[model samples]
Each structure stands twice: as C-alpha cells, then as structure tokens.
Target: MIINAFILFLSVALPGLLLTRMKSFSQKRIGYFLVFAGAYLFSMTVIHIIPDLFLSEEDPFKLGLYILIGFFLQKILENFSNGVEHGHVHSHGGYSIPYLLIALGLHSFLEGSIMTDSIHSNHRPDSVYSHGSSPKILLGIVMHKIPAALALMALLVAQLKNTKKAVLLLLVFALASPLGLFFSEFFGHSDVLPERYLVIFFAVVAGSFLQISTTIFIESDPHHKLNWKRFSISILGALAAVAAQIGF
Candidate 1:
C-alpha cells in the first residue's frame, strides 16, 4: 500500500513539476490531449462499470437505484466543481480552493475504494489476476492525475503568490488518493457498505467518471483545428483507457 501510494504520488507530482518548467496553455495540442484523456475516462467507465455492477449480483431495481443515486450526487459535485474531475478546470468564479480540493478528494477516495474492492473481489480466488482493476486503475490514475494536479497547482499559483502555500496545496492534492484508499479499506471490513450499497457506491463513481468526460469534451473550444499529432495522442489515450478496461 505504501509503495503503491508513493508511486502514485511520484508519477503525478514529478511530471507536474517538470511540466511546471514549461509555460502552460490550453492550446490545440492540449485540446487533443484533453479530449483523448476524456475519451479514456469514458472508455474506462463503459469497460469496467457494468462488470463491477453485475459482480455484486444484486437485484436489478436495487442496482438501478444505486446507479441513479450516483448520477445525482455526481451532478451535484459538478455544480460546485464546474466539472474539474472531468479534467476541465473552471476559474471564472471566486476561488473556492478548499471546496474544489474537497470535491477532488472525494473523487480520489472513490477511486481508492475501487482499488480496494477490485483487489479483494471475493468472487475470484486468485486475488491478483492478469487483468483486474487493482493494477490497471492504479496505472490509469497515475497516468492522468499528474496533469490534473499540475492544473490545480497552476490555478492556485495564478490566484495567490505564495509558493509555500501552493506547494502545500499540491501536497494535499497528492494525498487524496491514498487517503481514499485508507478509508475505503476501513469501510470494507466495517460492514458499513453491504454488497447492495457497494454496487451503488461504485456506480456513483462510474457516473462521476462519465460526468467528467462529458464536461471535458463539451467545455473544449472547437475553434482549434484537428491535426495529426492531436489525432494520434487522442487515439493513444483512448486505446490506453480501453486496454485498461479490457485487460483489467
């Protein structure tokens, strides 16, 4: 768990640090990358959400309820986040830094819950499979989280001039997934989340992912032209998301 968390942090923070060296802009190239990342989020939700839902073996009515609940709550978060979890950061409003961080943290916690549940899936005797959410989700989170973190950091820097506060803010962002992992594991054994509720909880997470993807694509300005480089990267991101879904 410690190693996994460390790797997660390093992957995001290091790349963010490196990228910080360059000027940040949401250019056509970035639009392509963002869109590709959004596609991956969508693909991952499709590839993984239904299987995890079915795995619970709960009633159809109950499952639907759970999915609906997830959809609604994620919608609420979007109202506040302007759909940051979807990879589109909103900056026009007042700097609700704490609120945004908390929302992002909640999203991270759901991600952690997915990790814990996927690894300990009681249906499979072999805990570690060639393709499972355990590793794949972790990898996917690592791949995209850095840019998300960097984007957050950049916004903070732009708003406030304190480097120390900005760095600490980044650290807090970095810790979210690990914190989620811890709480998810705690809840697993506490009987706080039954199979019926687990389905809903995870489904909500899927809804969140889907919500984020939609926000990214819709929020992107179409004034940017399509280019070969953008096309290729988008393909890679989409394929990677699919691969994670299929393989996991």
Candidate 2:
C-alpha cells in the first residue's frame, strides 16, 4: 500500500516539478500525451473496472446510475478545477486559489479512496501484489496525473509568482490522493461496512474516468479535424491498456 501510494504521489508531482524547469514543455506536446493517457484510462475503465463492478450482486442498473452521478460529480469538480484533470491550464486572471485547490483535492481524494488494498484483495484473491492485481486502475490514474500535475503547476506558478508557494501547493495536491487511500483503509476495516459498498465506490470512480477520458479525446484537438498521429497514439494507448489487462 505504501509503495502504491508513493508511486501515485510521484506520478502527480514529479512531472510538474521537472517540467517547470525544462521551459520547453509545450502545451501541444502535453495534448498529445493527454490523448494517449485519456484513451488508456477509457479502455481500462471499460475493459477492466466496469466489468469487475458487475461481478457484484448489486443491481447493474443502480450501479450504472451511480456511474452517472460520478460523471456529473466530476463535471461539477471541473467547473472549480478549471478542467485541470483533463490538462486544461486556466488563463483567466484572478482565479480563487482556495476554491481550485479544494476542488482538486476532493477529486484526488475520491480517486485515492477507490484504490483500497482491501478492496483489491477482495477482488483479486490470487494476485501476488499486496493490493491485488488492480495495477491497471492505478496505472491509469498515474498516466492521467502526469499531464494534470503539469498543467496545475503551470497555472499555480503563473498565479502565485512564487516557486516556493507553487511547490507547496503541488505538495498539497500530491498528498491528497495518498491521504485518501489511507483514510479509506482506516475506515474500511470496520465490521458495519458492506462489501458491496466498495463496488459502488468503484462504479462512481469509473464514471468519473469516463467523463475525463472522453473530454480529453474531444478537447485535445479543438479543430475537429483528422490527425493520424493523434489517432495512432490513441490506439496505442488502448493497446497498452489491453496489454496491461493481459500481462498484469
């Protein structure tokens, strides 16, 4: 669990911290990477996570409704995050830092909550990892986080004009996800909690994944014209997801 949380933290913070110094990390390059991450995430959610959710005895219809709620929940978060989860860097001046951080933090927290080791153990009893074979979901989140962290740091540095302050904010955002996982693990051991609740939680997270990934695909190329490179990268991303499913 600590290893998984550490990997997630690095995924969400390292890229941004490194890219801030490079100066040549263009948004266009980030967009291409975002497409790949988006496709990979979408594929994992559809091919792995959603199917696992259905393995539960819960009503599929109600599970789907929770997905829809999660989808909209992400939409609401995006309004405050300025679409940071999808790699959008807000340019408007005078944005509220507290509001943005809160939204981002909440979203990250939910993401981390879905990555419980106990849940993974319940779902994949035969896996070797302590957390089970849910690396696909974890990898997807890490892939998505790279560009998000980059965009977020860019915005924060621009807004605060202080490297120390920006780094502090990045640290806060980075910790949010791991903290979430800790809290979930802490509370999940209680006897009163039903096993099906984890399934519902996963379904909601899958819904948010759907929304974010689709948005990345749609918005990555604003012109709506065909680009073979982007399309190829997207396909490669899907293939990568499939490979992870089979290999891991």
Candidate 3:
C-alpha cells in the first residue's frame, strides 16, 4: 500500500514538479501517451476488473446498472472538470477551480479505493498480483496520471498564473488516489463498510474507467483522421495489459 501511494504520488508530482520549471510543453506527445494509457486502462477493465466483479454471485443486471451509473457519473463530473481526467484541457472561462477539483478528486479517490488489495483477492485468485489491483490496473492509473499531471499543471498555470501555487495544488491532486486506496483498505479491515459494498464500489469505478478510456480514444481523433502512430501505441498498450493479465 505504501509503495502504491509513493509511486502514485511520484507519477504526478514528479512530472508536475518538472513542468513547473518549464516554459512550454508538448501536448502532442502527451496526447500519444494518453492514448496508450487509455488503451491499457480500457483493456484492464475489460479483461480483469469486470470479470472479477462478475465472479461474485451478485445480480449481474444490478452490477451492470451500477456500472452504467458510474459511466455517466464520470460524464457529469466532466461537465465540471472540463474532461481533465482524460487529458482534455479547456480555457478556464468562468469555470470554478473548486468545482473541477471536487469532481476530479472524487474520481481520483474512487480509483484509489478499488486498489485495496484484499477487496479483490477472492475474485482474482488467478492473478499473479493477488494483492491489490492487478498490475495492469495500477499501471493504467500511473500511465494516465503522468499525462494527467502534465495537462493539470498547464490548466492550473493558465488559471492560477503562478507555478508555485499550481504545484501546491497539484500535490493535493496527487494524494487523492492514494488516500482512496488507503481509506478503502481501512474501511475493509475495520468492517466500516461491508465487503459486498466494496465490490459494488469496484463496479462503479469500472464504469468510470470505461468512460475515461473511451473518451481518450474519441477525443484523440475528433476529425476521424487515422493516426497510425497513436494506433500502434494503443495496440502496444493493449498487449501490455494482456501480458499483465496472463501474469507475464
């Protein structure tokens, strides 16, 4: 758990910290990275998380309904977040910073919550990473976090107009996921929330992952023009998820 928290923190903090020193950034490169991360995230959900969720004897339709709720819940959050979770950036343009953070932070927290290792052990007994999330899911979050940190710093810089202040705010964003993981673990161990409820929480997060990853793909090419480089990168990303799925 500490390792996940540290790594998750560094994934964003390191990139955002470095960007605070720079005068310019390459959104194009970051976009490619988002593409790959999105692919891996999507594949992880399809191959692992969703399957594990269904491994429960719970009602499939109900679980799926919760997933659909999470999918649109992310959409609602995007209305406030301006789609920042998937690397979409927009002009601050009368948008409240607090609202964006609340929406995005909720997202960050839930993803982290699902990272609790014991939550999925019964479901993922076949997984090599039997502890927390399968390696692919954690990697997916980290992969996306790097580009996310970049876009966030850009947005915050544009709005706050102070690198120091933006980095400070970014630290809050960086810690949100790990806190989710930590608290989810805490709740499970203490019986603060029942294990079945945790599984429901996992389903909801799975829905959000679907929303975020699909959005990345759609937004990556609004004009529908084929970009082979991104195409290949996405393939590579999916393969990486498959490798993790098979315990490679």
Which stretch of 10 consecutive residues in model 2 shows the poorest summed lDDT? Answer: 124-133
CA error at residue 212 for candidate 2, angstroms: 0.5
Off by over 4 Å in 1: 23-26, 91-93, 118-120, 124-131, 189-193, 221-236, 245-248
Assess candidate 3 and give its lDDT.
0.84
Q: Model 3 over residues 33-107: C-alpha lDDT tens digits?
A: 899999999999998788888887679999999899999999999899888888767664666789988888898
Question: Residue-wise lDDT of candidate 1 within 1-248, one digit each (tens)?
Answer: 66777776675567556655768655555566677776676676676655556555577676666666766777787676556555445657575777887777777766666666532455445522323566666766665575576666676677667766877777767777877677666676677677556556767776766666666656663555655565576578779877766555
Per-residue lDDT of candidate 2, residues 1-248 (tens digit): 79878988998889878967877677888888899999999998888777777766789999999999999999999888889888888566566789999999988888888777565555545543323444777888888899889888888888899988998899889998899788777766765678788778768888998999999988866789878899999999999998988877
Estimate the lDDT of model 1.
Answer: 0.65
Could you tell me which residue pairs clash in candidate 3? 117-132
Question: How does model 2 score by TM-score?
Answer: 0.91
Per-model tally of clashing residue pairs: 2, 0, 1
Ranking by lDDT: 3, 2, 1
lDDT of 3 at 197: 86
What local lDDT score does residue 116 receive in model 1, on the 0 to 100 scale? 62
Candidates 1 and 2, the one with greater lDDT:
2
Write the candidate numbers in order of decreasing TM-score. Answer: 3, 2, 1
